[model samples]
Target: MGKGILIHLQDVNESKKSSKLDIWLDEERENLLCDITSLVKIESVAQEEDPTSDEPFGSECKKALDQFLYISRRDKMESYNHDGYCASAIIGSSNKTKPEIGIWNHLDVVPVGSGWTYPPLKCTIKDGYVIGRGVQDNKGPAMAVHYAMKYCLQQDLIKNIRVRQILGCQEESGMRDVKHYLENEKAPNYSFVADCGFPVCCGEKGHYNVTFKSRNYFSRFKELSAGTAANMIPDEATAVLVTEQGEKTYQCRGIGGHAAFPPGSKNAIGMLAAKLKKVIGRDKNYLDLLEFLYRTASDGYGRKLGIACEDELSGKLTCNAGILKLEQGKTILSLDIRYPITVSGASIKKQLYSEADKSGFDIIKEEDDPPYYMNEKSPFVQTLMSAWKEETGQNDEPFVMGGGTYARKIPNAIGFGPGQDRDFSVLGLSEGHGNCHSADEAESVDNIQKAVKIYVNALVKLDQWVGKGMVNNENI
Candidate 1:
């Protein structure tokens, strides 16, 4: 677990300026904590084995969705569940002349890996932070949006706008929940996903998942297994090798993070493969594959594969070998790649196939999703950035990201904050302490409260901006 600068709850209250929104947030802070705590205790990790016709992800996900809808109904907001994939709570009535804005969030969390001092399911409030699995990645922000909408409803501030908070249960696995929801409903013309950083995410790189399989035997390697999910960097990996003396076990450890941002976390599968290459020598075909992974795929860029590239807006292409396993005499390696927005999926595939042919591996399966980009000069992007700047007093420009969010799913959506770069630089704390998808995930209480205020301001501003026809509806 990463250590963060501990702050007391009192410090936040003292430092914040007294404003109507801030005062209201201060008064409702305890209740907000209670809401998050209650929701986190349900353990809403999606499981494929537990899936049913009624509960697509699992019963735990269904439980989380049901609980969220229950809270929305109690608050007197209109709530609806789309089968079992997703649920939504509408805070305001649609105005015939105004555009509806959607706030997208996820209820599902990643599996709780080992090494947690606090229980992963219990939302622990200590040292002015909410510590839990979903607190940082999504759950906390979802709750914040819930309260933001509630605030809008209570104040009757949503006169000419409609704000719908859509919570999905399959963001971690694949975005099937949102897909199902879109099938039944039209895409919101202007929306924001509260699953990323502030200053707004105007561009997102393309996403690709590729799996390599080889049936050829490894003479000296017996078994190898590592990784939890395709979208997360593997933190730990183990390999059993048939050595000269006997079977030998080896383990490698590295920091894990979301694959989109690989600089912060290390890849354990790459580490183990590099070590095994030295032991087994590079002459073997298996060692050759390991060498390819360690050299080209280990680093964020696709340097060794000769496909490393970048663009001015979305930056460089990144590749993470997230999953690796050797079973039933078949070795498999799964890669998560985020390519530059300017790059074509067909070009990337051709390059990958050429390299695989030379490296003695077959492409078992591949999935490609094109990049998503919004013009920074557009009214929608500017409005979101302006809202963030006004609230935080930060003048940083809107930037692109390698991570994919619900923003990509929605027609005209971008990723807005529950995180800010300053949280890591100035405050000595990263969102969730920079432990998303890793053990001991957490969210700062101060950040959560701050996010609520930002969301409230942004929603209010958007309502006025869109209601007045300041936005280009055609672009959306």
Candidate 2:
């Protein structure tokens, strides 16, 4: 199989003017599969309770970090473990100077929920797909960049440019890994996070998570819980309500999807809340809260709350009632809102507070991250665009996304893709791959291979452009 891959590599090298990146990826396909599979099996789900002095995120996250660093060291690369928050592997110049380009990805995945044709932790390669949690959301893309660096190292393609691949272990949770790395290490002059879709993601909407809680709410509900993560639309929710005759149990079922794109998903939390309201009547304070959610939960544009807004660049604001729980006699609802680039967090918050006050709920906690954007005509974007068009023969323009990535955290950084918009149509899979925080997450091997090619070419082009002094890091 190895020899066959090499033969394909040689054939492509002989036939094409472009670099043999695609062929080299084909050659290393099995190795790529092995690397991602091995990393996936470690179950690197970040747990707040598992933090220690050595492992800030958790022991499982630390284990995943250790495994990644071990692979880097084995590949004869300079690697560092940053107190377990994140890890970095460097190829090219060994100088302590700043790196010219940075490739960022996350290693930690969201908690694997129930329902799957295969175990979520074990990598299952079947019919040209790599199925498992974190395969697409991050781990696979990270490995793709890793192997791209390996290709550059073997070909001695490292000239004046140095590439740093930083892998974080807590992206799905709170992105503290990258946060820790940036504090201890110098930020890359320019970076691209491999955590979005193809073409290029030049704009990302503001991310705000708001929690509504009230202890004074009148409720006959004894216990209720739904959703495992705040960024995912709840698929299943259950409530045990106190009734006049006897205690009653209720459940709501809906399709789960990424909170960023919530239009198609039927939020289970919202559904259950509506069901409870119907049974318990609308006069209760708890029902009022549920009533607000049930009315606006499915509206991605924030219309029912009077905060509906949109702009040409990033489109409309979206909101998802991601989590619902009854604890300590207080009913809590966690909302994940991705607002348009034009809207201010303050504006959104004011409207939300107004609605919450009217509904008799208090805003217990609110966290806001401003939107991130780069002018489409910048040298950085153009460089990546050229590489993408050259490799794919498509001239699609760079666009905005609702999903926030490390791009929002790093200066002049943007989200590039290992997956494309057409991936579903091409591969015959549904949006979010029926995984992405849902059960049985999987990423296509073919998509990973294509992304490897694009990354290699982009790195080569970026190195050349930076070496020629085309990009001014200070201005960028």
Candidate 3:
């Protein structure tokens, strides 16, 4: 764990704080915790999709949506669930009008894997932190934005500008909730998903998800179970092999984290695949496929597949073999890749398909989420950066990231704070505890308290900016 940048910024910024919102936040801290706790208790992990049902993702997601709307109504905002695919809590207008700013937060979290000194499904407010599965990844941040909207509305700060707070049900799976909403509704002029690091995100790497299967049957391996989700680095991978001699089982363990940020995470699947390849891999139909995948993307860098590239903005391309399965002699491997902002998704896919075809693999499923980028110097981006600077007194410039957020799916939008940069000293950082997808995910209460203030201020300024039609014309 590293010393957080927020700690330094807070040390300097708190001394100068004198806003009425800040004072109100201090008074309402306990209430805020209650609301956040209520949310964390819902096991809103995505389940089998039922398109015909109102709760398309699952009952838990629907329950999560209902809870969010309930909280919104409690906060005196107009709230509605859009057939359980997504929902909204809006302020500033009762009349039908397009929103100027949209705040996106997801209720669904990745499946809790292991390692917990605290509970994974419910909130555990300990020391100065609120710990749970979705605490930092999204739920806690979502509530911070929710409270900010509440503060703005009660203070009569939201005037001509209408803001829509969006709660997504399938962010963990594929963000189908937001996709369905945008397909049936109009998006806000400017939106920010508080799902990334503080300051601001000006660009996001292109998201390329692909799945390839073995061309021939590999009957030796009966079962291969690994990874919790497509976007999470696998912590434990197990392989069961049926050989003439006997049955053999192989298990590999490694540190886990969100696949997009693979620095701290160690890939267990890659480890297992490498070990098996060295020991028994020979034919392209069997263990050799794992060897090929591990060799191509083991390090999370796309250097071997000819997709190794970087830009001045969004850094290097990252490739994680996050999902793998073997059923009925077919070997399936799925990759979650974040490519450079400047590169063409088409070109990358072309090269990738060629490589797989030559290696005797069948490209089964492939999807391209094109890269989104805005000028760092753009007035819209600077305005967001200014809000962060005012709140934290930190001068970290607006950045581009590999992590995909609703900002990429929404037009002319960027990602703002609520993302913890690193572990603050006061949180008493411990090992085996992680943030976002990792187990025992945590969010400091102080972090939430300050985020509300930051978001409240940002919302006010963003409303003004959007009202002016200061759109990023170049990107749009």
Candidate 4:
């Protein structure tokens, strides 16, 4: 997402400069593309709880981990799988004397959504861009981080700590994979999650997950279903109703996006419910459940539910009725809410619980992660921003975003980039065609190559700071 610091471009007449590192980077471009393609071919979407299954996340996630490690081993790199939840590829020796640096990226992607000309699973290369489900949001950046490790090694740019790239399997659904990871292994001293924009992300908004189940089943409706993930806005919703004539099927379509940034996204679940409120004709059979959906899901903000709030640093509090279905003869709604950094999770819960109770829905599940913020004046952040400035000749500063990255959970970590400076319009794709959680997700090849250079530079800088003023900044 182009949510990072705004970049100031140089004059077109000033030709771009090239270094020896860039020359070597060009040679590895094909390898990088092959690595991304290998991982993206698998539809690694997170699935529901399956206690009987062998893998922790799901079968597809297991396959993703297997393929990632197999490629690393085939490339003569040391790789490890953490019980099918996460996988790691290591470069250089491990020494506890120095900090162990790590790079975090996720393997699992959101469900393949509607409206796509290109296949969602295949990594299609067209017009200098890699198009697929997970290419832009994660898989493409994951491979870019992997190549940065190679570049660091080949140029002898590392001496302090071994570089490890950790790929987790559940980022879109919930961060259960991260909890399992921290329990089994040690957290990296100073690391970065390559899942956001550049120069660096100093703050990530708090994420509050809430679910509501209706008090009673709909007496007048036959059935209803929509959405697959908690973090994506529902694009289409279907409802079958017992009308005056007979049972009729009604469908509602709206724009979808990642719930963290829901400005232009319209909730189809809310749209359908609002229309049905008028169509139900004072029957009162499904009035209670219908009113709840219409009030909360009608807009991107949670104003109707009285949970809306905002602050300057992290922007507004966004809510999405991502999942709607019938379970145990009751209507259920899953919401993904991202609140401001200055707000407290307890306060949000207090407001949300009161509202849900008033609206006649019981809270079944709640997951909360408080906001994470790093001082912009810190040496670690300055170093990351320095790397970006050096690479792009821009003097952009650090920024705060709503997207909750691993930095919120990992110690001394921040959201770095495969920057959003890439031109997705290169392929002439229309609007709604190139976002992370939407269909036809893509990232430019040239953009990823540039990211490799930035990561290598950042890695080299991080390695040099192992012994110096490494105080509050653990890795530094």
Each prediction's TM-score versus the true structure: 0.90, 0.92, 0.90, 0.91
Q: For model 4, what is the C-alpha lDDT against the true structure? A: 0.80
Candidate 3 C-alpha lDDT tens digits along 1-476:
11232123232333444367778888999999888888888999988778768999998888888889888988888888887888898886554553557888999888888766678877888778888888887889999999898988987766656789888988878888888899888887677888888888888999999988878787788878788677888888888888888889999988788878878778888898887887674665655577566766478776768778889888888888888888678888888889988899998898888888877788899999999887777666666666778777888888899998888888878888787655645555554456788877888888898899888767666555434454332421
Candidate 1 deviation (Cα RMSD): 6.5
Give the alpha carbon lDDT tens digit for every residue of 34-62 in model 1. 88877788788887744448798888888
CA error at residue 184 for candidate 1, angstroms = 0.8
Residues 254-314 of candidate 2 have per-residue lDDT tens digits of 8787888876677787788778777776556766767776755756567878888889999
Native-to-model Cα distance after best TM-score fit, residue 141 in candidate 4, in Å: 0.6
lDDT over C-alpha atoms for residue 165 of model 4: 90
Q: Residue 19, candidate 2: how far off, in angstroms? A: 6.7
What are the Cα lDDT values of the candidates? 0.79, 0.79, 0.79, 0.80
- Better structure of 1 and 4 per lDDT: 4
Off by over 4 Å in 2: 1-19, 49-52, 421-435, 469-472
Number of the top lDDT candidate: 4
**lDDT (C-alpha) at residue 269 in model 4:** 94
On TM-score, the leading prediction is 2
Better of 3 and 4 by lDDT: 4
Candidate 4: tens digits of C-alpha lDDT, residues 307-423: 889997777888888999987678889998888888888987898788777767899998998889998877778777877887778887788888877778888888999857667
C-alpha positional error of residue 270 in candidate 4 after TM-score superposition, expressed in Å: 1.9
In model 1, what are the clashing residue pairs, if there are any? none
